[model samples]
Target: MTRPTPAPKPSAPTGTSAAHVPLRWVGPLRISGNVAVTETEVPLATYESPLWPSVNRGAQISRTVDAGIRTTLVDERMTRSVLVEADTAETAYAAARAVHDRLDELRAITRATSRFAELLAVRHEITGPLLFLRFEFSTGDASGHNMATLAADALLGHLLAQVPGIRYGSISANYCTDKKATAINGILGRGKNVTAEILIPEAVVAARLHTTAARIARLNVHKNLVGTLLAGGIRSANAHYANMLLAFYLATGQDAANIVEGSQGITLAEDRDGDLYFSCTLPNLIVGTVGNGKGLDFVQENLTALGCREDRPVGDNARRLAVLAAATVLCGELSLLAAQTNPGELMKAHTRLERLTGARDAR
Candidate 1:
């Protein structure tokens, strides 16, 4: 009998062992939009095995239609807020006015920090003697977290020199609202604002999803809209947007923490005749094509596979990536909502898939 080999020791830090999560490519999802027009399989890395089939179901439905999932780029901007202190509110107000007036100079300063960072807007709020300046920028390709922060640092120095009586308080004022569930990101927008929508025929819905258009639409109103409101969810009305977002973010090497605000979105469903019109509007879908995590071997391969690594204009690749992310969100959201429409279907699928995964692990 052959002797069993001992488990290899981890070369990484003790706590940072190479723990693996199961990753699978799901769906040659047909997506049509201003940014991307392709049938692509998405890579999702997650322990939740049910998501793969759930999203695959939605993807199958997409292919039945001519246009498939339609993703639209609503808006795009990355923001960073810097804090400064003045002697009085009057001085703070003066500094804010000066900053607003010298927009050209500030744009130059922001550009000097990074070739990709371009100043889009500058918003300021003054309370007592404190000034919070939120600087929004268009960062090309990269997600623009570090880029925005670096630009904000340089802009802070410039503001201190040009605007008198305001000294540095902090680099981030929480007004940018990065990685946290806040209404500001939803209202003013922080990252990629993309909406993914699909119109499923009544026959397809009943055949694939085992539900009717009216049932799904009514469920959306009662469960997603009203339930979220009753729960006091801030700027969010959706079913399991974070589930798909996290899986996609992990596979594509995005800042996974961004799912906090990335998950804040609305699910709109309508009973159009007998067809089902499902849409997901994600205002804070933060993703990047070339960033910190893109250097990873798997991330590079995944981006290339997704066609996000194509040599496009500065922001085009990132926009394509954002649109893809939004479409994936819709796929998962639609499938889960459809499953919930039938009693015990959701739990049965979860229990069955998770058990299969566990059995495989045991093997």
Candidate 2:
């Protein structure tokens, strides 16, 4: 696989509104790296800072909740169209599927590496005689937006070279739906559908967060569910899953814009025996162990500190990173939910954290 380009730099530093202060290390949330779970406060300090070199600080509320990560690598699809000059749209779609089935039969002859893209399904759109072939692949680990594209190219070449009566209309068809939200991807899922769940006890919610599970459930029902439905939202119905995802992405080397899909998540809660079973599912989490700015000094150091810089099976590392990201999202989600349980807590925490950090830096 080709190396992914570097991640962009963090936006211009803010005066007091900056979400993070340079050299501020946020939490050893889990028993990560050399830090124990008890050392939840600033376990991994920002690496290679000029001023706050020795001191370590954590993403305050982020350190409280526990998160668990799980990764899934399913087929992400893209389109390679074939020109089927047929009498009608019905015939055009049939023509594309027939070619796909033929290719499926000859898989034994066409495939070289197991990594060679396998066609999962064939979908088509009919514009009179023009037929668009949207092919799906069971791409592993690496978000195969580009992988599927390359594989589609090769597959199209093979079809044209070998298959008779398979005329080509185009290869660069957008049906594969790269980097955008589509209903198909939402249902089938694209990239790593990483889910992070935490069962917060009633006692902990009451004592630490000043909230009740019943209230949490009610809030989600009205705000996330009904509110979003009323507003005509698509797919997701959650509270600020993107906040944590974006913060983590900026720290790590990832395509920040992918938060578009990453943010398309569902935050669900159940009052399980008085405890809140909170989970966030980011179906379109596109992250990797390698690629992007993984080569950067700061990003590399952060990954190492997060214990994500390790050798594992081919897709294991990337999946691990996905889970970690999901876990982080859960942490922030839980914390913010707790804060909102009591009015003004969110801004108050901001006042204490951001304003104080800004004040400290100015000093």
Candidate 3:
């Protein structure tokens, strides 16, 4: 009541102050994948205290298996969409055709923009006098947001100069569907599309997860598949991919907002002879080895620790990072789903862990 101390007179800004979040290294998880084959611990920065132990439990299970968490890189690309207005619908259609036919020329423009950004494909949508061109590129090492944008800018400039009867509408037209949840990103692919799989023995599932394989499989069907369908989820079917993705993204110096689309994934489970076959497929795992936000001291340390700072091929580091990120998701998703299979298990764990840490409103 004696006046709040005037909020300490509002300290002066020092350019930018760091927002320090709780960081922990979870898991010496064994991940054997197309991109990575190593047992590594991942750094996760999140406010959720329970996630550390939850992922750690899944990591423990991974150690018991021979193959461990097997990750596969399905596809990888970053897209940038540019909108242009034509004089008429026919002109827009013609311009779209011209762009598609001139892929080589566009590639040259993209190459001129950035050495790492290579033009992969150009797809277009025409609506009346509007033309939306989605340019896809393979951006090496970096997440490719800036690289794609720079290439798109150059391509757009060339199109305006050469293509007739079209003017710039906007650099982005949502057709690229960067962060927003959309069906196209899942179907066509964006970022690093990866799938992580693990086959747990019957005894391991019973002893570690404390649930039968049949129960976890049934839960995946009812909760992940059907439940997501009922919830009108655009292109995602998972219990809590966002939680792990957010933590991993923060720790690895990724564009955390990319988790919006990055979390759009599928969790598949099957009961095979009392064993469990669990997999998490993330189609939009947007991460990078070298890019913005990675220059920070802590980020550099984390990346180096994760073996992403190696002098491998141009795109290997980023792909390796993506694989690890997917494996991390599998660990967290598997643990959370196992917890949810039993009534009150999730809440009890949350309450106990949060209360132990003195977090407000433990429940």
Candidate 4:
């Protein structure tokens, strides 16, 4: 994957002298990396009810209760999409065709097949094996975590059954990282669960580019960037940002625990237009509607406000929020950089704001 161009140096702030400090400069400026800025919005589309034959009303009620808590407890059902990538565009197309054919044949099977109510779409292509497939499945009122797993497992089983010479070693399932095994052990004892894997060259490209971008951004840090900022401050900022976003995710019927892995965001900044040009990315964001949890009083309201209903077009609102978060952090960092070079002005402004607002502390 090709790396993004290096950022230009930022011009020194003008007009305002260090004497005209701002109250906001008192707190440590938190900045996210480039990986946190890129986002793609997806709309939740209609799917054939996979729950009807699989779940009884009583079980469904239990699922509703679980969904209310932003948990992923529910009956297992299948929902899947296939992605294929290769060295060349032609090769990739050929692989996709093969996978698509295989999926169709699987749908024809007795216990393994069912027609998808929603047609699948190719989300985006980054580089290498970096392709994303979003299956808009309706998991009733709870998060469809189990459903996604079942679908992936069944699909893998079919693929293995039909394709010879492919071993488990060739496949690596991940929502966030390989270390999920450790996190799962800490949270839910060793329980075997279903997982999803999509093969896409674009995914590989995206990952490589993202990693490179992060390295480039870190290199831009200088002596002035330290002292004022704590050691490992960037990581701390990311963690703080993740936690804040998790609160919103929980409040909105998202499986907040997934944030433990999916909460990662990347940021990249360069000098542009006399300001910083920045980008961020977040992946593995699993959200659901028409689940048990979404029926909660506040969740339903928030989803409505966000236009996230079962019938609406897949939206990019979530991605946009992530980008906004990156921008906020970049602004904070710039403010902090200025403050470190000239603290007296910032201190005075912070003091004034505290007195005026009756605030007791200033970071």
Using TM-score as the measure, the top candidate is 1
Overall local distance difference test of candidate 1: 0.91
User: Model 3: residues >4 Å from true position, as ranges?
Assistant: 1-18, 359-363
Better of 1 and 4 by lDDT: 1
lDDT (Cα, tens digit) per residue for candidate 3, span 109-137: 88999879999999888898999999999
Please give the range of 10 consecutive residues that has the lowest summed lDDT in model 3.
Answer: 9-18
Worst 10 residues of 1 by lDDT: 10-19
Among all windows of 10 consecutive residues in model 2, the one with the lowest summed lDDT is 50-59
Q: Note the Cα lDDT for every prediction shown.
A: 0.91, 0.59, 0.91, 0.33
**Please, what are the lDDT tens digits per residue for candidate 1 over residues 162-236?**
888999999999999899999999998989999999999899999999998898999999999999999999999
TM-scores for the candidates: 0.94, 0.75, 0.94, 0.39
User: Is candidate 3 or 4 superior in TM-score?
Assistant: 3
Taking the tens digit of each residue's C-alpha lDDT, what string does model 4 give over 214-291? 322343344323421565432222212343334445545565565554433333344432222333233333445555
The pairs that clash in candidate 1 are none
Off by over 4 Å in 1: 1-19
